[model samples]
Target: MKKSKISLETSFWAGQEVENPFEFLEVFFEYANLDYYKETLNHFLLHTNKLEAYEAGTPGQTFIIYTAFRSFLKACFSLKTKDKKLKVRKAPEKWSILGQASLTSEEYQNPFLVFQKAFDEKTPDEFDFFLCEITHLSLSPFAEEFEYDFITPFIHLTKMLDAAKIISERGIKKNKE
Candidate 1:
């Protein structure tokens, strides 16, 4: 996959020296995987979640989360591509999320808003909405493959989903003030 490049000066997070966001992501999605993760998306999200904790809002998390979201969709695409019933092969290679978000608080194009809307619904519509979103949008510029290197609001939604699941599965609860 051909990856996009950004200058070191352009990619640094606030008060933190991080490598290019996409470069950091390539380490997991492209270079190597940890045995404990059991899945690439899990491993990738784990580290991004950690970094997000390192500093609340930063450009670094954007890239990390962006890659994670894309990686998540890539895995989903791989599974559903061959299933004619799903028709995932028709979706855009880079921007694969399901809906078109007309408004956003941060950087996002067409589909990022779509994901935010689904995730915000707080229902089971996320994946199902994505399935329909992929088949419905116009084909991206690339016909076969593309390596995208930017983060958008969609990544934030994935983290929210993970935390919600972890809070329940891990039995985490907030203490009343």
Candidate 2:
């Protein structure tokens, strides 16, 4: 019988059991504690993957999606000492044209304006492949933190926003008719 090797990164980050002991945890902690690394981890773990459930645009899924994102943002950026909360405000009307907040803010920066600038610098053609890859929906959760997978929530948020916009437009059209 063959035994499986334990995950070093998971064991180190998630405090899971590992076969080999990590000797330099103090050294590792220094890098892991940095804001840059934390942001990098957030970028990949919390904002990368798309969820199939969200993409399906199924009823009642939107609420769960928003809940996940609210929990994720609160968990990652919440300041327990001062009780500061990262407010996930609704994106203003003017910002709707930007390929939705779900995809942009994750990679370039947390703030929407910075992400807009970064996204604009690159032509759409440059990102076609990358965007296509991001749109591929999978049932699997990308990464778990604080007891949940972080990325899918943001994906659901974007999908819900799009659905809301479509419904609003249809209502306006009906009123005009």
Candidate 3:
């Protein structure tokens, strides 16, 4: 039998052990209060939507897709920090959504305007403070007062693979339909 070449997509998903590692990590990291896993999942959903729009003759939709991609990158970087709690602080602020939308608006218009408007209407609550406190605690390690075990690159790689798998499956299903 002839051996088939493994595509980049296949390699990426394979790295995740073909399981929903993000969901697992979400539960695991819940105690850290970083919500990093949840953010990652959100980013994936946004990207999937953007890609679907693009394929349906809405090229302008790439704006949202690209924004989600950038957000995912930021989340990945935050995951690299020693303090898991601080990872939330490293997450891009809502302003980033506006900035990205601006960059892509000349072509697609500002799709994020709706999100910005909604955010503006909401007031910060106890949950917001709680999340901030967690972020502060995570960042405290960099203040020379605490230390944390270094996160291995393998773990990050695995998480990324899992995310990619979910994305690929979604994309494939969309294409097929």
What are the Cα lDDT values of the candidates? 0.31, 0.31, 0.29
Question: What's each prediction's TM-score?
Answer: 0.22, 0.19, 0.21
How many residue pairs collide in each prediction? 2, 0, 0
lDDT per residue for candidate 2 within 113-139, as digits (tens), equals 322332344332333323323332222
lDDT of candidate 3 over 1-177, digit per residue (tens): 995422212122223221232332332333222234445334333333231221234433433333333333333332332122211111133334432322232212322222223224332232233233323333232322323222222233233433333322222111121
Worst 10-residue lDDT window for candidate 3 reads 82-91
Error of 1 at 16 (Å): 25
TM-score of predicted structure 3 = 0.21
94, model 2: CA deviation in Å? 23
Residue lDDT tens for model 1, 1-55:
9954322331222223334332333333333332222242333333432322312
Candidate 1 residue pairs in backbone clash: 99-114, 101-113
Residue 6 shift from truth in candidate 2, angstroms: 47
